[model samples]
Target: MTDDAPNSSTPPGLLPAGLMDLLPPEAEREAVLVETLMAAFAGHGYERVKPPLLEFEDSLLAGSGAAVAEQTFRLMDPVSQRMMGLRADTTPQVARIAATRLGLQPRPLRLCYAGQVLRVRGTQLAPERQLPQTGIELIGSDAPAADAEVALVAAAALAAAGVPSVSLDITLPTMAPALLEAAEVPPALRQRLARALDRKDAASVAALSGEAGPLAAALPVLLAAAGPADGALAALAGVELPPAARAIADNAAAVIAAIRARAPGLRITLDPVEFRGFRYHVGVAFTLYGPGTTGELARGGRYMSLNEEPATGMSLYPDAVLRAAPAPAPRPRVFVPAGTPEAALQALRAQGFATVAALSAADSPKGLRCSHRLVDGRAVPISKEG
Candidate 1:
């Protein structure tokens, strides 16, 4: 073969990095999970909204969407002759719809969405360029109650989706930045300190305290305050923060209080100094984890809508959710012989059996991978030994 010729051993079905075909029950399971989450949101008065997968680059990366700009995949639109981008996340699209399409709607408009997001690259932990997301947004409200509602709704949705032992880790993304600003830390030092805090490097955080001043001293306290909800809240309360940073802490406290009041049994944690992965969150932010999951099952928080309306939302990763959720029992598949009446096949389907009609006499139930077979116009279980 020539040097440029394709390798003969390479599988024709091979996909690019960070992409794959979801097969069989796995695809169905993800679909069901998405619906389960959407149902949970609908039950709480959140209406569903669907946005196009691609949009003009300018609009797609506007406002809060700008946060994911680097991750978005851009291409030129043949018709409009403008740059178009695939969404890296769904929140910005929902925000855009709410601001422009539904701008005249009522306040505190609750909207939910489910879609696939394509990113140019994936994180080391996730490593999936295309991800399915189902989430909700509550726009035009900045109250602590609104924040609590989103968090609570997310927990309830995950529970409904069968994610067991789910824990919510709440963070104040602006807390560390506010502290650095209040301390009058230089721009370069602020960036360094922020990086240290993001990595949870206690030694570096403490080392920078001298130059960061009194307010910076609170950074270490904030870092240590990360833990179970109650204790973390207490530690955060004890720290003397500047006004801006202190207000952020208070808002977090109120939101936590509301959540505790409703879901006292929920496992909640507070990370006051976590400033990473929340580029647009101006207030409280959170991540959801389940037992046995590799990374976060979901993440979201308070952010402004496209029109600057206050909004908070959460997005669940159905792929991770499926890994965390219990595997659903597979539906029985029934094999129908060729020449079976159309009515009989319809009846089998109506009875909840997946009918696989044989095209030839040689096809058997076992060969068709079916658990049952149609005989005498009735569905009967196929014997394993047969």
Candidate 2:
């Protein structure tokens, strides 16, 4: 066969990379998951907000937007004759809403959002360039309680979505950067240290920062202490850090303590030097993972909204959340034969059955996967053999 010839099993209408069409009940499951999460957020007083898919490039790329600018897809707006962008992340849009539209609202605005985001590229772990994210943004508060509250609320939402035995990993992305700055490390060495931390390599961190004096001595300890939360916090407490860096560590400890108080059963871990996906987070950040899952199920942390107001929140990946949830109970489907009384069909629907009306004489209810069929003025279950 020629190189371009399609294989026998390869069907037509192939989708582009990082995109897939959801068919059947899977699509319905996703919608239900989103609604369940939104309801959980609402229970915690986070009002729902929807931002448009496209916005002027300048507004969309401002502040935290700069961190995700590369992933955003840009287009030209015909009316304004200006560049526009399809948002790669909804957090930035929510931040914009807080800063501009909801400017006059009370302090500590609690806002939640659910929407699809389009990215230009995808990572190995998450290949879908199109993603559905549902999250909350707690703006204008930097207290440790705010941090802890968001974490627990996220966990609560996951539980509501039926994700079991969830574990949370909290990371301090700002810790290493602050220590490097305090040590007066140059730009080149700082980049090297960051790369080492990404690999969880303590030896490289020590070697790179060895000449920076006291800060160099503590780098190895910090990297080594990244595991269980209690032990990691104990190790961190002994390290003599600069005043500013120490405060950040203290905030993280407080948040962890608060979470423990609220959810003693929840598993928690700490990583002081993790800096992979949190480019804009300024304080305690977290990622949620579950057993049998390939990548992080959700991620959130403290960051400046609009690069001005302090904000803390988390976003759950709908696809991951659905994967982690128990499979939904099968839907109740019934088939109404042609010439069946309209009242009968209405009664079936009222009785919690999903009715499928017969369009032709040859259409069998069994062929449609219907669990029951209306026959002779009565609804009866379909038999397996017959």
Candidate 3:
């Protein structure tokens, strides 16, 4: 901040750093979505995994191929400058928990996490540094069936969250990476080209590739290769893709078929642009976008599903999701007194009430500010203006 800017000490009704103040209704809405999601996760026998928010850089990194390495926040440890970091993503930590920490526990470890991840994605993602991500990671299995199951689970989770008309835009990085390699592009130029391809701007892609000879030969086929599940698969029909590409395609097709079998009428698209980014995702990745928003509302894939280093998993920006979910009933909040006993509280919870037990107006106003959630009757819960 500039010296001309207001001093940090001059604050009430001010926020610090990247933290945000969510009102009761907003908080309650999130809780409702989470409730549905946790039930979905549990109904299918996926065990819950809660990793710590902080970890040593080694553990979170675990020698992986993620953009998280740069985004991780560093800190000096009181004992040693071992360089701790607030985790940028939880998959690597969950992978570690699966592979070594809980290896003896089970096969095909099904795990889900709901927590806030800190990162530095560019402004296109709104530069909102701290985001809440709730997702699943299935380890110890790379079955095509596993891939299908996860896609289904992802779709189901979005459905449970009250997100409708969800679209699964799928892709395989293997083929595009191979095709670019066959064209003998440089790393820097290839990055620029991939970006253009992501934007679906063939003119820019051709310019970046610098030779129409390759791009002209490649771009049309790539650009034309977009549509519904079966039709898009036809684009790749009988073409001999590289081995990695072929495997990726077959697996992706299986996933699409699985989704179709389970949930008909759900739209599925095949586009290489869907792979997310060059540095982050891998084979069989997808983002679930739909009617409410221009950008992706939810995304996940079978990234680092293997024993590879630098694990990959999906993350949902909760605020982004809140923006994407259709408007809900404005906050439903009630007040509860400070000294409510546990037994009474459980009874209220059994009826789907969220109890806010703070005493004073300052301490308890938050209870009433939330929608569809209530304060435990002790505190005066309504807005003063109301």
Q: Evaluated with lDDT, which candidate comes out highest?
A: 1
Among all windows of 10 consecutive residues in model 3, the one with the lowest summed lDDT is: 371-380
Candidate 1 segments exceeding 4 Å error:
1-11
Ranking by TM-score: 1, 2, 3
Per-residue lDDT for 281-341 in model 3, tens only? 6667767785755577666666563256323345554566666676675533444566667
All candidates' TM-scores?
A: 0.95, 0.94, 0.78
Backbone N/Cα/C clashes per model:
0, 0, 16
12-70: candidate 2 lDDT, tens digit per residue: 77877999998889999999999999999999999999999999999998888889999
- The prediction achieving the highest TM-score against the true structure is 1
What lDDT does the true structure give each of the candidates? 0.89, 0.88, 0.66
- List runs of model 2 lying over 4 Å from the truth: 1-12, 376-378
Please give the range of 10 consecutive residues that has the lowest summed lDDT in model 1. Answer: 289-298
Error of 2 at 227 (Å): 0.9
**Cα displacement (Å) at residue 3, model 2:** 22
> Which segments of candidate 3 are over 4 A away from where they belong?
1-12, 16-18, 121-125, 186-192, 204-216, 238-240, 278-280, 309-313, 326-386
Q: Please, what's the RMSD in Å of model 2?
A: 3.3
